[model samples]
Target: MFPLEHIAIRQAAYYHPEKVVHNDYYLDHFKSRGKDIARFLQVMGREQRYIAAEGENALTMGYQAARKVLSDAGLASEDLDMIVFSSQTPEYTYPTNALLLHHRLRGKSRTITLDSNANCAGMVAAVEQASRYMQSNPHVRYALVVGSDLSSVNCNPEDEITLPNFGDAAAAVILERRAERPGFIDSLYYTDSDDCENIMFPACGLSNIYNPEMTPEQIRISWKPFDGTCVVEPAAADIEEVMRRNGLTLDDIAAFCLSQFSLKNIELICEKLGADMDKFIYVGDEFGYTGTSSPFIALQRGIEQGSIKRGDYIFFWSVGAGWQLPTVLFQY
Candidate 1:
């Protein structure tokens, strides 16, 4: 159990692109493919999603979100001790997105920056890392944690299962050291690499790197094919373990901010855990599954809608592409 009493979440913010794609767009796109667009929408509980404009990418959205959180906290880029940017849809394989964001945000040279490719679980994993840093380093006053992804760019429009499920977004939060109260209560992470291929981009990794003959066209065609059903059992087990380890029941949690994979999946998980469906924030209908940014965006939206409040015991959970599951229980 990794718990931090000194680190506190100072602020949280998110950014979505201006371009929007309605369910009608998917309905038309999948008509010839024999996909039941109406049934898909009803099952997934998704209506529309925001897509990135021509120039917008992960870094740009993340930078905007980071700036918003920092500005709201009344701090400049120079005041940050570290920046942790998490995403699978990076602009480039090299020159990590975190460093690029640090440069774009005009952070000081001394500020440490790095990236985590934890997929959907990136946000909670980042918070765990940032909280640990603040706990160990007395001089580190503030750290910026960002989870941003443009999953639309990695999706194949022809694949009905993968196409309408994703939307582009970025979310950021500022973590500061405060000696007054507990911040992170405990966090548990579980992964099963055997199921990694269940959700993956087949052409973007070492296989393409080793095979120089692979062209850009091959890479572009290699979109992620996901099996949404594969996550249900693992998520249920992980959530159970987290609760057992922390000695808490479903009723003890005030709010549950989970990955915006789909409303059906969220409801299934809630049923498996015997959790109240009303306590879980549902944002996929409006935002689609924003990949790593889902949980943070949901948390922000819940707070905005007066559903979540301070001193409440909040549970943050997500299952990522690598079959990674990270569950965090904390007091807000």
Candidate 2:
């Protein structure tokens, strides 16, 4: 089989601000000076996080970044064959962020647009979706895969647990068919919905609709550290499995980009697998927890900084709501 040569990335770009509630200005108002959140964020390997300014939402961010990718590739909106969007934060859960972005892209192209609710693991799954769709219809020369999240918007202001850590951001990657070496090598996806409730925004659903009287205070938001433990171990295990099947190991990986929710989790995962934790990048400190956008942003930043290069093996591991863990291995 010929290698996939044309499967190049079109300069992934993102939009986010560098200030949020965790900063010194915001923290100074708190009785403890937001030290708890600041220290937690520091240990998580996040220095600062970005927040969506007034009027900015998931759709806007996604639309803007996707446009960047399109412009960078010198491809018109009409050239896009499909729009695959992945995000936990959407303009609305019903219309979905993907459809919203499709309209924002001017609806000029008859692209088959679909949205995935994969949270942090959504990017890997979206890549899988694009790969299968492109393989089936080589006519679809280009696909825009977007990861735009507004986690900060959902954080209950009164709920200190989630309020301090959530942030907002968006990223886009343009993928095309390549008739050469492998571009997207392999992937593994798994979920444990039983533990889904462990880490979740337990409010804002149909159930809450029936009970409007349930105020924000009544809404339970569990942001405890252990909330992520269950999925972390499985995520690491899945990464190992993917590596084993591909005849590769951690050493072969040029970089490892995950959800970037916490620096501690990144360290633990690398330690468990005996991987080089130094290769891991952290944007959560500056971008906050951008949900699905984490991995995409990481990949883009890695390439720009010369950390990720052509022909380098890169692995992705992401875990978030729904207790889901998905992994992917690729060479760029």
Q: What is the TM-score of each candidate against the true structure?
A: 0.91, 0.89
Candidate 2 structure quality by residue, lDDT tens digits, 144-255: 8998887776766655446666678888988877776547787888877875655565455547745868776445455544555556688788888998998987778889
lDDT assessment of candidate 1: 0.83
Instruction: Give each model's whole-structure lDDT.
Output: 0.83, 0.74
Candidate 2 has a TM-score of: 0.89
Span of ten consecutive residues with least summed lDDT in model 1: 216-225
RMSD to truth, every model: 3.0, 3.0
In model 1, which residue pairs have backbone atoms overlapping below 3 Å?
Answer: none
